[model samples]
Target: MGNNQPTEKSVSDTISDAFQPILETPILNIISEIFQPNLEIIPKYSEPPNYNKEVTNVYILKLTDDKYYVGKSNDPSQRYLDHATESGSAWTRKYKPLEIEKVIKNASHFDEDKCVKEYMSLYGIDNVRGGTYSSVRLTNAQKGLLTQEIRGAKDCCFRCGRDNHFADKCYAKTNVHGENLPPKKKIVQSRININELELLSSETSSD
Candidate 1:
């Protein structure tokens, strides 16, 4: 009779076929692990730092009287408390319960002074004080004198002894009402006298 049992080669082929699926299972798992969405949780990204956070800032406060106060402070919150308690400037004291309208942070004194001047320009020079305000108006003669005096000046003001401003333009030299001292009549008289003397000298020289 022909052999009814499977041949050795056929048995080996059956074993190989059975092991193929088993070998493929581990490779399939590896591929799924590589391509599968990550199951491990990851930490969320953090928010960026706020560069505009107020530190040594310029702030504008709207007051109860409908006026505005422009101020500069390293800590605006503390300054606000001073203003609310009437320990601030006279202007802020008169107009109580100020609310901060805007803040400009991370600025130098020059920048703060610039902001204050801009606010003054928009609202009115009298809106705020104790910082830079409207520049004092100089008469032609006063400007001439100021120019002459400042030709060799290491500093600005002769009156307030400040560096960057002339005597006539110094706010500290102003009266309590913020008006400049009346232009010295003595200087005017001296100028007129000198002019007259020059005229007389010229007439004599012509003769």
Candidate 2:
């Protein structure tokens, strides 16, 4: 009850609290405003350059003559226009392309190959020109040569230059198209006609 007055902090106590280390201070879930000296800076993620190619689509065009052409492109509309104008494919030009019937987006060449084969099976191989691979083209040409043979035509295959089962069942990997095959040597047989022989005899008798 004697000298009831509020006491103030001592000068030495205030000085010691002011000089305390910051690490000793209590904190609640606070991050630093600046980075550490030894920290590594990571760059943000970026897309690839061939991202468009990776997301390209496999599509099918329905011709006016009930045929189908399977292909791959990122822009199906432009590709369809090219086919409609008769600038895309020989098959499309011959059959008159109508419109795009199907489109499988984000497709690869392998996916295109499978789609083409499926279309070929659905609408006979002769009606389907199929995909744009070397194997597909070579196979179609071989089938054409086989059809020629079935029609009694003496046309050799564009691949091996042979008329028999060479083209009918050829499983060649590349589209050599008779490039590596040996050149065909022509056979000429000279036969004397009856009139020519009689004239020769008369000339010999007169001589």
Candidate 3:
């Protein structure tokens, strides 16, 4: 006859194993509670900053006429308002009134002056700095010629200024051309000869 029995761990061993899981569970829950909110808030501080600086230089166009007004200012909005007012300068006064069609902003002082000059030149206005228009009328051919003259003056090509050959065939490269030719190489010539006496001796022996 055999007795049926169940193997069992000690009471202390059971308590120890259960106590470890209970201790570890509370630790994991506490760690998760502390870290989750920190992860959520970290992204908010990492965003980029925004800048809203205002532009200062501008171009004003008249809506009703062929005239365009180009000028520079530290404050473009104020300048435009002043130009539209009743006490504006003689140029704006003669035009009777004006409307701004376009505004170019944030140009350097030199660039602003150049832009104003170019625009005045295009519209056949003289004394661009003071907004003075000349009464002298230019024919189309004359206008084209004047434009070319101004452009040539601005460019001031050396060959054109010197009245020499054009830029494409300037003499500056003449010395450089002489230096580029291939250096000379020496060659020796030689002649080859066969002796008639040796050939005759071999032929006689063979016979």
Best by lDDT: 2
Clashing pairs in 2: none
- Of the two candidates 1 and 2, the one with more favorable lDDT, higher being better, is 2
Q: Estimate each model's TM-score.
A: 0.38, 0.41, 0.35
Q: Give the C-alpha lDDT of model 2.
A: 0.67
Instruction: Give the Cα error of residue 166 in candidate 2, in Å.
Output: 24
Query: Which digits, one per residue and each the tens of the lDDT, describe model 2 over residues 1-207?
Result: 697786788998788888676546544322443433444565667876775556678889888778888888879899999988878887787788777899998887678767765665455556777565323245666766444443333354545445554554654444323235444444699998999999999999998
How do the residues 50-118 of candidate 3 rate in per-residue lDDT, one tens digit apiece?
322434565654623565556656766677677677354555544533566566667554555466556
Q: CA shift at 6, candidate 2, in angstroms? A: 69
Worst 10 residues of 3 by lDDT: 127-136
Model 1, residue 34: C-alpha shift (Å) = 68
What does the lDDT come to for candidate 3? 0.52
The C-alpha lDDT values of all candidates are 0.63, 0.67, 0.52
Candidate 3 wrongly placed segments (more than 4 Å)? 1-55, 63-65, 126-149, 153-207
Give the least accurate 10-residue stretch of model 2, judged by summed lDDT: 27-36
Across 1-207, the per-residue lDDT of candidate 1 in tens digits comes to: 988996567887889998987677788797887789765776678998765663467777888755677778988888989989989877777777557888777775567656654564445444543354423343577444533443324444555434566665555745323446544333334335888889999999999
